[model samples]
Target: MPHIAVIGGGPAGLRAAEILAEAGHGVTVFDQKPSFGRKFLMAGRGGLNLTHSEPAPDFLKKYGAAETLMARAFERFSPKDLVEWCHGMGLKTFVGTSGRVYPETMKASPLLRAWLKRLDGLGVRFCPRHRWQGWEGDALVFQTSTGEAVRFTPDATLIALGGASWPHLGSDGQWANIFGKADIALSPFRPANCGFLVSWSEIFRTKHAGEPLKPVTLSFAGNEKRGEVMITEKGVEGSLIYAFGAALRDAIEAKGKADITLDLRPDLSQEALLKRLSAPRGSQSFSNFLRKASGLSPLALSLLREGQKDLPLDPEVLAARIKAMPLALTGTAPLARAISTAGGVRLDAVDDHLMLKARPGVFVAGEMLDWEAPTGGYLLQGCFSTAAIAAEGIKAFLAPA
Candidate 1:
């Protein structure tokens, strides 16, 4: 049996190691961190959204252009399969109202604990704090915890080192240089599913720093998504902003700013809003008037005040502007705060099976691949799906008979 080396202890590496070890192969997993699943644990802190319960087609579309490439991996081990696998390991799951599947325990710790036990029983080995530094004369090299160099010559290798985000928990993207030297095209890591920075007036920042903008429609570049966003001391983030992160991010990257328009009342018709604005204000406070006539939520009122350059203006124009409030996002919040990463190994550098074209016997999987998706379990879905595919590819390569 061939000995396989899986570099990374995140979802992809763990999944692949379990599969190979169970199949009677000697599998060893390596990670620089002392423990496995740091990022995975952080992801579960908010509740482990494993995969969405959405239909397969819609779920697959969440992957964007990488759909065909990732679909192959997912088809063999789809979201339904993931739930079954979790259940077999004594982890029960349920689908949320938003269609995101979560464990009955609602925390990834229970499921992860069971998963690690299963892998241990399969004879999988885990090497902690072993930082891979790429190949050294046809042998893999890593920096040992004791500041010594160690080498290995496995029959196959799978690199799921993850993307450049949340460096404290590992996956610092320091591995990017190794691939660049290996002649693989590297997509510079950037923030995905991240918040954007919008400079709000000091008053608004102080007043509504942690406020929630619920049931609002945020539109950018001709696309709109309806969801709640949270106002931060520095900027804004939430389901709606994350849904259109790429569009806003690209605009900021290219033109230095992204204009986003928010529809305070999406459900109301323009004529109806105009009628509501035509009603007499009778010199009531701005907040009280908006609450009584416009029916804007508290958060909406705060946002409206922030956008209002000059108060006490004509009610009609004010209402029209409030109907479509424009705000310019200056830049990204920060990579460390990103839920997932945007850039990684470009697809052109890898074969259909995700094997690095320049380096044979080396495969890539998980978020390290060049693809990004909105949250709601899609990110985790891609990780496990790609790992399954990598396992099959390794199987074909080591023993084609």
Candidate 2:
């Protein structure tokens, strides 16, 4: 039996350990945290979007440039395989209204508790409070919480140290430097599904901060997405904003600012709004007329004022403004505020098996790979798929029995 060492207790590391130990290999999962799945727990706070219910090709496209790289890994353990794996582990999942798959209990605590129990039963050993600090000779070196440095050489090693985001969760992305020292190309860490700074007026911030803008559409450049967004005192966030974050982030990095437009009423077209404007105003106030006619929320109207100095009094002008509200994006929120990261170890550094070309027995998976995907279950899907494929690769690499 091969001795397999997994360098993170997150989803990918734990999943890989499960596969390796289940195959009768001795497995050890190391983490700096006291327990496993800290990020997974944080993710579950928002109902735990396990995987999307979309079709394969369209869903794979969510990974953007990493689609091809992720596709090969996912081919061995697609979303369907993830569902079956969870079910096989005795956690039945149900699809939510938005096609997000979640455990039957809805909370991640139950499934995680059960999954941990299953892993323990499978003979997978978890060494918590042990932090990885690169390699010493041919052995893995780690500093224990008790201030003791330990080293051990394993038959195979899997690195799933996660990305630069949520560093507090124990994924500090320090592994990238270690890989770089080994002559492996690394991608600079950046925010992925993150928030953008809009520089809202104090009046709008005081009134509408933390308020939800639901059933609206956000449009930037030629791209448009429809979803709910949360307006913060400092910026705008939520799924819709994160969906366009990569573009906005790139624009701000390329230039100085990005001009983003939002449609408070995406359901209503410009022609239809023009039709509404054709209606007689009579003596009705503009705000009241807008509320009753367009059904625009107060927050939506406040967002309109983020750039509007004076409310458009003309019916046609008001209609046009209502259809397309513009806001100049100052910048992106800090990477620490992001939900996930966009960059990590370069894919070219790893072969088709995701093993580092520089280090034969070493492998990388999860967000540590240079790829970015949107929310709505894509993130967890990636973790499971990469870890599964990495496990298979490890099996093949050690397959001389």
Candidate 3:
């Protein structure tokens, strides 16, 4: 039997190992972390969003520029296939109101435990704290936790070391430089699904930091996302901002700053808001009156105040401002703080099988590839789908023709 070595214990590497081990190959998964799935567990702290329930066509669109490349992988293991795979592991899943799929327990622990157990039964081995350090004359080299070096020469190897996001969880994107030495094409990593920095007033930052603006609409570059965003000490972040992260990041990169519009009262029309603001201001303070009239939260009001020193008392002006308040994003959160990363091994560097054309039998998958998707379960789906595709490529490579 051919021996296969899988580097990085992320979802993509694990999935690839499972497929190879089940196909009768001797497989060993190596990771620098003390345990596997540290990042996966962290991601599921709130709730494990496994995949989206959106149709294949619409779901594919979430991948943005990588949609075409990812479509090929999704053709084999799609959202439906992912759900079924979970079911096969005895883990039942349900779709949330927003179409995100999660296990019954809404935690990743149980599912990961079951998966590890299954791989154990299939004779797969895991070597933890073994960090991959570039190759030594076609032999894979790793540095042990105790500062010892180890080497292995497997029949095949798959690299799924995730992106630059959540570096503390193990994936720090150091592989880019390693592969670059091998003459492999790589795109520099950038923050994705990340927050942007806004020069908030000290008063607003001190008061509204960490406060959430719910039921708000954020529009950028012709794209709009209706969700909630949290005001950070530096700027704003959360679901709504993440949806436009790539565009916002690019805009800031091109123009030095991005001008975004926030609809504080998306449900209320300008006319309705104008009528409400036209109401007489009695003994009630302006804050109290605006809150009752427009249903704006304290955080929303603070955000409004951030835009201008003094809000317009005129109903028309106030209504128009309320309808579309401008916010300027100066910069994106650091790549380390981003939810995920964009840019990686360019698609052209890898063949259709995801194997690096310059280095045959070395396949790449997951976030390490030059593809990115917004949050909302698309990231996990992309990881799993690409892992399956790469695993198939490995299997075909090892099989006798």
Best by lDDT: 3
Positional deviation of residue 256's Cα in model 3 after best superposition, in angstroms: 0.6
Q: Candidate 3's residue-wise lDDT over 1-401, tens digit each?
A: 89999999988999989988989999999999999999899999999999999888999988888898789999868889899999999999999999899999999999999999999999999999999999998899999999999999999999999999999999899989899999999999999999889999889988888888989888877888799988899998998888888888999999999999989999999999999999999899987898899888878887788758688888898888888999999999899999999999999999988999999999999999988888899999999999999999998888789
Better of 2 and 3 by lDDT: 3
lDDT against the true structure, each candidate: 0.87, 0.86, 0.91
List, residue by residue over 114-171, the lDDT tens digit for candidate 2.
8899889988888999988898878999999999999989999999999988899977
TM-score of 2: 0.96
Please report how far candidate 1 places residue 29 from its true position, in Å: 0.5
Candidate 1 Cα deviation (angstroms), residue 278: 2.3
Best by TM-score: 3
Lowest summed-lDDT stretch of 10 residues in model 3?
300-309
Can you list the residue pairs that collide in candidate 2? none
For residues 134-229, write the lDDT of model 1, one tens digit per residue.
Answer: 998678999988998989999989999999889899878888999888779988888999988988989889888888887788888888888898
Q: Assess candidate 3 and give its lDDT.
A: 0.91
Ordered by lDDT, highest first, the candidates read 3, 1, 2
